[model samples]
Every structure is written in C-alpha cells, then in structure tokens.
Target: MKQLTFLLLVLLLPSCSVEDDSAPLFIEPIYVNNPTFKLKLDIIYVLPNEKYAKSKYNIDESKYLDYLNGCFFNRHDIGIVLGESRTLVNPELYDLKDDRGNESAIFERETKGTCKPDRLNMYIIPRTNTIAIAGLGVTQRTLITDEFLFKTTSPHEIGHSLGLHHLDVDGNIMSRVKPYLRKEFNSEQVSELIQQIITINNR
Candidate 1:
C-alpha cells in the first residue's frame, strides 16, 4: 500500500511536470517600438585577485571571454562589459549583516559587474570596498575551470549583480541562496534577459 501511495504522489507532484521546450519564452514583449529602463547593466568578469588567488580554481586567461560573451551577449545583447583583470568596475559598495548577528560582507560582490541603481536586490556581499562577484561565493579565479563550473559561474554571478535572483535556490546557476549549486537558466531565462536588453538598448 505504501509503495502504491508513494508512486501516486510522485506522479502528481510539480516536479513531475514536463518541460515545454516548444513554448516560446515568456518575455513581457516590451514591444519597444522604443522602450527604456531606469537601470543600466555593466558586465564584468573575475580577475586573478587575492579573492581568486586563494581558491582551487584557475581561470584560463585566454578562454575566459568566450564563455562570458556567450552567456551575456547571447542572452541579453546589451550591457557594459568589463575585462576580468580589471578591479571593481563599478565603484559602488554597501555593508550588511547576517543571521548570526555578525556583520557580513555585502557590497563587494553583490553587483558582480552590473549596477541597477536602487534595485540592487540579488546576491549581495558587504566586506570589499568595491561591488564585485563575491556573492557568487567564487572569490578566486584559480578555483575556476575553463569549462563547466567557472564558465557558467562567471556569467551567473554577473547576472545576480544585474538584479536576477534564485530561480531555483539549490545549486541553480541563477539562485541567490547560499551553499549554491551552479544551475543555468533554461530556455525561459533567455527571454527574460532579452526583454531587458531590448528595453535598455532601444532606449
């Protein structure tokens, strides 16, 4: 009886839903004939700074841009891009605290490489003097890989800095939750991103 009941629950759960690959991504159709947004996104990549100097990852100085470009340009088509070797590209930083009553780092990496003015809501860090990718929890460039982890991670972190949050809290590349798992946004993600780009660029 328990076996049958378990089987039924699994079948009925939302997790059992089928992926609708054929469905067009649900972009809000800015229909911009000419649209504008109050925010501007600046894309930045990780540098081999003290932050990454301590990690097990190693970023390939050569191949870094390939994935970064693919992730952002392929998705949104608009946003300012900063080189990985550069220091905090955007000069905005803020301080914050955590649940343990201990003050936490906030502004350093929360913005990855983008700044949204008043809407900086996703992955925020508080320690560093510059807004960076720390919220991605990948501080060192050495800990990165040419493929997989580091490649996707770089862009994902930058996205958070732009104002994106966890689509899936667990390891989802787009998640804002801690102990993160690098999850990539699906086909649907591209649409949401494009909407913003068109709105921004068309402005």
Candidate 2:
C-alpha cells in the first residue's frame, strides 16, 4: 500500500510540472550603459465622452516604455523621457475615422489646442474606425490605439516618426508583420534615427 501511494504521488508530480512548463517565460533584456540622447514624449488620452472610463485596455504605459527603452537604449543609445501628459474628453475626435483623409483632418483637430512642437506628441484612442491600422506616425506626431500600446507597434510607429521606413524582414523593428519577432532596428535605421534626434534638438 505504501509503494502504491508513492507511485501515485510521482505520477501527479509530472503532470504538475508539465502544467508549469506549458506557459512560456519571457525574459526582458538588461542594459548597463545609459543612453546618450533622450527625446521628450508627451501623451494625450482621448475619451469618447465625459462619462467614459479610462482603463489600460490591457496594456500599461510603464511596460510599453520599458520595452521601448530596452530596444532604443540597448541598441542605439537613445531613450525617451515623459514630459507632459493630458486627457482630452472630446467625442468628435475620439471617434476617429479614416474615410477620405479624415484621419489627417481629425488628427489636426485633436492637436490644435495642445500642440507642443518641442516634444513628441502621442495620442491614445479607444479604437480607430479602421481595423487594419494599429497606429500612425507623421513627422513629430503619433496616434496609437489602446490595444497596441504595449506591443511592438509602439516602437514601430516611433520609428516612423523618426523617419524610418518599413522593411520586409521578419525581425526588424520596421517590419509590417510578426510583431512578436520584431525587435531591433538595422544599422542604417539607427544612424537615421539618431540624426533625426540631433536635428530636432538643434532646432
């Protein structure tokens, strides 16, 4: 009877171990050197109405910034510092649509009152009328929905704001697909991104 009990316990242990191993563990990268260039970032959260609640939409800002810093500082000696943040309760701007260049029209309206030329302007929305686009970046401005805040989409749009173009490679930061695998910017992109920052700082 004692031997049978021991055997049953051993069988259960393997199943428990299997369950533990089922989930993949993600280890974040470590950085020892501080970045030389730091860009100022400003965020604006748009709510549909005054009564609408603001949740993270399953993605927190700290985690997104952590991932952004890890990729930029670790590779290119670039980092972002939060400068200003605000919440805009505008129903018209919140319901953004991409119909017939309305995205640009709505973006202009959203930033008209709060535009800061010195810092990177990031607007967070609940969702876009278009489902295919996760975000859009033009020059110094960026618009990202809540659901993609913590994904590689954040960095990808920032790359565009810094003048980096899209790449077909699976692992490049500017890739159009494979968000999980996209990690680092290529050497040319690094140089261009740094140059853009320098130009902006000099201005």
Candidate 3:
C-alpha cells in the first residue's frame, strides 16, 4: 500500500508540471515582420466661429504623424496617412459634450455628410465635458479633443476603431494609464489589427 501511494503522488506531480508548461510565459508585442498596410485619415477640425475663437488649435501635423508612425508603423509596419483635411466652424459642435449618453447624437451631427467608409473620419473638437474621457472611436470614426491633439490619444482611439480593446498593461498602446509609456501593442493585438486592415481594404 505504501509503494502504491508513492507512485500515485509521482504521477500527479508530472500532470501538474505539464499544466504549468502549457501556460504561456510571455506575449510578443509584434508578430508581423513585413506589414504593407497604411490606413488613410480624413481629419476635420471643428472650431468655434470668430465669436468664440479665431484660430485653430496649436497642433503640429507633422509631429502628430511622427507619433503615429513611431507607435504603430515603425514597430509593426502598420500606420496611418493623412488624406483629406479641412476645418469647420460650429460653436455647439466645437464644444462637444460627447459623453453622458449624448455621444451618438453629437457625433452624427458633427459628421453628417462627411463620413467616408474607406477613410477613417477623425474630428478634432474643442473638448468633451470631462478631461479624463479625451476621445471616442466607433466603427471607423474617431473624435479627439484639442487638449490631447498631440498625445498618444489618436493612436489609442484608432486602435479601438481597428477592433482592439483596452489592456491592463501599462506600456501597451491600449492601456488607459501612463499615456507617455503607452506605445506598444501585444502580438495578439497586432494580429487582430492586421486582419482588420485587410477587411477594411477589401470592403
């Protein structure tokens, strides 16, 4: 009986070791070696009329493009290129109250007659009701506040438009904390974004 009990314990130990080995030890941030996809963007800056504001937000378009490339294209071979861009004046839409269950109506009004299926529709607005919620991305449209125009917010929201979800990883592009540290996407997310780009291109 003692010999049989010892043998059973040894058998169970091997099974447990197998389970541990099956678990993944690490997740790669980039799986694609050569990516040839570049998403196009139609950026629209919505500003208030002269009565409210006279100049556009202080944004450096070149720097913004560099950020996008550094965060996604340089690392994973996928990036975004600016296509058509314009500015509009509408005080109400400029000061966007995007949250509080008012997102759909507000977004629709702001994007009316300007939404394109092939290009990502990005609206640069004055701000939302709260500073914490800086942007919104649904389908292929992304709305960004002027305050976060030059931060990692665009790529973060664009990730959502590409079907990626928020991650708890601090240094991940999809994370909600430490905006400066958020730059990389996990391998799974890279794979998903690649698929999404293919689907969008085919559509």
Candidate 2 local lDDT, 57-130, one digit each (tens)? 44466666676687544557887777776677876667665443466556666677775777677888865443
Estimate the overall C-alpha local distance difference test score of candidate 1.
Answer: 0.33
Mark the regions of model 3 whose C-alpha exceeds 4 Å error after superposition. 1-35, 49-55, 98-101, 128-132, 177-180
lDDT of 3 by residue, 129-180 (tens): 3333567766777777766655556676777777777664656766654455
- The ten-residue window of minimal lDDT in model 1 covers 11-20
Expressed as tens digits, the lDDT of each residue in 1-203 for candidate 1 is 64334321111111101111112222221122112222232223333334533122333433434344444343434333332232232222322222222212333344434433323122222223222223332221111112333334445544543334445444444533332344355445555555544454454
- Tell me each candidate's TM-score: 0.37, 0.73, 0.70
Which residue pairs collide in model 3, if any?
A: none
Q: For candidate 3, give the lDDT of residue 95.
A: 58
Ranking by TM-score: 2, 3, 1
Among all candidates shown, the one with the greatest TM-score: 2
> Which is superior by TM-score, 1 or 2?
2
Model 1 Cα RMSD, 1 decimal: 12.6
Error of 1 at 53 (Å): 16
Where does candidate 1 stray beyond 4 Å?
1-62, 70-133, 136-151, 169-171, 176-183
Superposed on all Cα atoms, model 3 deviates from the true structure by an RMSD in Å of 13.0
